[model samples]
Target: MSFTGTLDKCKACDKTVYFVDLLSVDGITYHKACFRCSHCKGTLAMSSYSSMDGVLYCKPHFEQLFKESGNFSKNFQTSKIFN
Candidate 1:
């Protein structure tokens, strides 16, 4: 069965909420902006994880992309394909 949840936006900011999945366990959800990097305080971003592939991350963190890209349009085409 497929799991589903709301893509809640943060009240403080417009970033989407992200869910983290742990191995063979119920996942945890957190506001994408609510937590910051331990070292740089950069807003946390979710990366796809795999036992072999591991978690992926940009060097400067995800928030930097939000700023630099200056574009926040959701990909309706991509999202619709999933639905």
Candidate 2:
């Protein structure tokens, strides 16, 4: 009994994601349609997003939150791993 295929649960919809439709970030996997900004509910498929405390946010919202928390810095650098 050997399992050959990979399946992951979508964090938002709590559904199983097949390998072909899976989108992962930082180790968590989600279905393509389940990936969106946690704040504004904007689509992140082709945009920059940031994850904090297991929540996803679009770049602008992430920056705003960081600024409000007094954590914004001029020397801040975001690693570009996803395109």
Judging by TM-score against the true structure, name the best candidate: 2
Worst 10 residues of 2 by lDDT: 72-81
- Candidate 2 TM-score to native: 0.69
Candidate 2: the clashing residue pairs are none
Alpha carbon lDDT of residue 29, candidate 1? 35
Q: On a 0 to 100 scale, what is the lDDT of residue 64 in model 1? A: 46
Considering only N, C-alpha and C atoms within 3 Å, which residue pairs clash in candidate 1?
A: none
Per-residue CA lDDT of model 1 for 1-83, tens digit only, reads 97574575543345555455211211433454444443244554444221112222344533443344454222112222343
Angstrom error of the Cα, residue 22, model 1: value is 16
> Candidate 1: worst 10 consecutive residues by lDDT?
48-57
Q: Model 1, stretches more than 4 Å misplaced?
A: 1-26, 48-83
C-alpha lDDT score of every prediction, in listed order: 0.37, 0.75
The residue-by-residue lDDT of candidate 2 on 1-83, one tens digit each, is 97566657788998778888888888888887778887778888645878777878779888876775567433234443576
RMSD of 2: 10.6
